[model samples]
Target: MNLPPMIAALRHHKAAVTLIALQVALTCAIVCNAIFLIASHAQRLHVSSGIEDDALVWARSSGLRRGDGADARARADLDALRHLPGVTAVAQVNTLPLMGNDWSADLGVTAGDAQPAVNGAALFLGTPSFLGTLGVRLVEGRDFHADEYVDYSPFDDTPAPPTAIVTRQLAAHLWPGQPALGQRVYIGAGSSQGALVVGVVADVARSAISGGTSDHDVLLLPVRTVAGPYALRVDPTHRDEVLRTLPAALIAQDADRIVTDREAFVDTVHRYFHDDRAMVWLLVTVVGSLLLVTALGILGLSSYWVHQRRRHIGVRRALGATRRSILTYFLAENMLVVGLGLAIGTCVAMWLNHWLGERYEVPRLPLSWLGIGALLLWAIGLVAVFGPARRAAAQPPMWVIRQ
Candidate 1:
């Protein structure tokens, strides 16, 4: 029951005690970080994409109907769909934002003295009506007009395309010193189809959730020049009805073309992170298992100590000590071991973070995690020691006298 005597007893079993301590420390460190990472990812996933994610239905249709009349056939199908019941504004785009099928290209801006630099990633491209369909806000420059899509007059004799509208972030990234208006930026090869910066957009969010960055220097062009999937927004209440009738609608206009199937916007975004999220859950499971193992180790060691010290415990019980006193003694010893483990675990957790930061995208261990981890280990120690404490209290004083 004495402190020094109990400490000496632990020293006699140094190897086993160290093993139990190490397990507790490692479990605390690993579990703490795993919980934080999962929380961070969940936070990212919950962020609003700034656009109506629900009340929207999207589908992908590709390949030519015999490759002979693909354009005419696909166009007819799209038009028919636009007229279908519950169908809202329908436009064809290369890719939908947040769906992760973004077409990124470098912009070469031509300033009088500022050389063209391929610096930022633009996360959008679409037809004139693409903006309206996706509900994107145009802050500065005008949207792509029909003439801009078909005209080659300015670029016929020149090397650059005549116009382009970019996001505010893109504007700042390219020309931080001055306005991006009227600035010429080259998009594709030979700088032949030059895009002029006619307007600046507030900022376009490509997905339902963003990772704290709204910086995009998007170059919106006529869909005629690009090749990709198109999105059509549908009312959520009518999603099932739309899905059931979409194929028939397209078939009514162009029976030979494929209408594909309808998909919810939420489903599309979820698919993007399905794999990453699954892996995070798997990591949490593994850490949970390790913590269980550490608890068992502590319990086993505590039980062993009570069994080995039956005579000592009996002597204490016989000397006017209550059952509660004997129970408290073992529990306090376990707490001390857990406290020591946590102290040592702090450095070990930091070492793990150093490796994690270098190899993975996870940030370094924050100070709060360390404190929380220590407290958690203390709780585990109390829980694990409880079993042995109860057993020690159950034994009668005469039991050790007989031994």
Candidate 2:
């Protein structure tokens, strides 16, 4: 029960104790960092797609087969659905944003006196109403006028082409608010095509959760007749009826083609993040497993110590040390070991965070976790040491004399 004796015992087994402490420290550090990283990814995965995804239903009827007459059937199907009940808005596009496949290319801008150099990339191709249908905000300039999207290439020797809308980020990068409406910007490189700056829009958004960047550099053009694979916005309450009627309407128009349906676009976006969103949950499982193993290891170690210290406990009891004193002595030793592990773990965790910050904008650990981690360590130490303390307290005076 004496402090000096207990300290001497710990020092005698310093190598073993240090090894166990290091193992515990490493486990804590890895578990905590994993938890934080998982949380950050989860937050990003749940971020809004910034569109009216809930009401929108998307169906892609691509003319994948070479020289197939399916394009005609698909276009006719789109027309049939347009007249379906509860269908609010329907549009066909060559490519839809966030549906996994995309058509993206590099673009360049030729400001007043600056020679055109390629500096931006955008999702090119869309009609004038694509912006409005997709619910994108116009920050400056104007959305494409119906005629601008339809206008042919100007015959004049002007360096820039007819018209297009650019995102705010692109605008700042190119002109920096020098009235982009009348300014001309050339898209593509080498033989870059000219598209007049008709509007400056707010930042483009990801089509779904897994999209890498905003649709910031989009150049939308209007078409008199769009091709197949249409997206429709329908009232949620009437979705079942719409889905039922959509196929029947298509069949009535063309018996050779089949129309497929899926839930609203929002649900599809949610599915994209399914794995990433579960990261936090996965981390919780891993941390829980590590803690369980650590607890069991401590318990086994404490049981072994109780057996080795039987005579010591009996002698202490014979010398008039109360059962409470014996228990407290063992508990204190366990806590001291846990405290050492926690200190080392905290330093390692800070270094890991520094490494993470170099690559990502992860937030620093709050001071509150320090106190909470300390409490958890203490609890674990106590639980692990409890069996040994109990065994020591049960030792008899006769056992002391015999030993």
Instruction: Tell me the whole-model lDDT of each prediction, alpha carbons only.
Output: 0.68, 0.64
Residue-wise C-alpha lDDT for candidate 2, range 173-258, written one tens digit per residue: 66765666766666545435567777877665433323334444455555433443566767777766776666567567656555
lDDT of 1 by residue, 209-325 (tens): 335453344556554333445456677788778878766766576555575646777787678778568867887788678778888888888888777878888888899888898
- The lDDT leader among the candidates is 1
Candidate topping TM-score: 1
Least accurate stretch of 10 residues (summed lDDT) in model 1? 150-159
TM of each candidate vs. truth: 0.75, 0.68
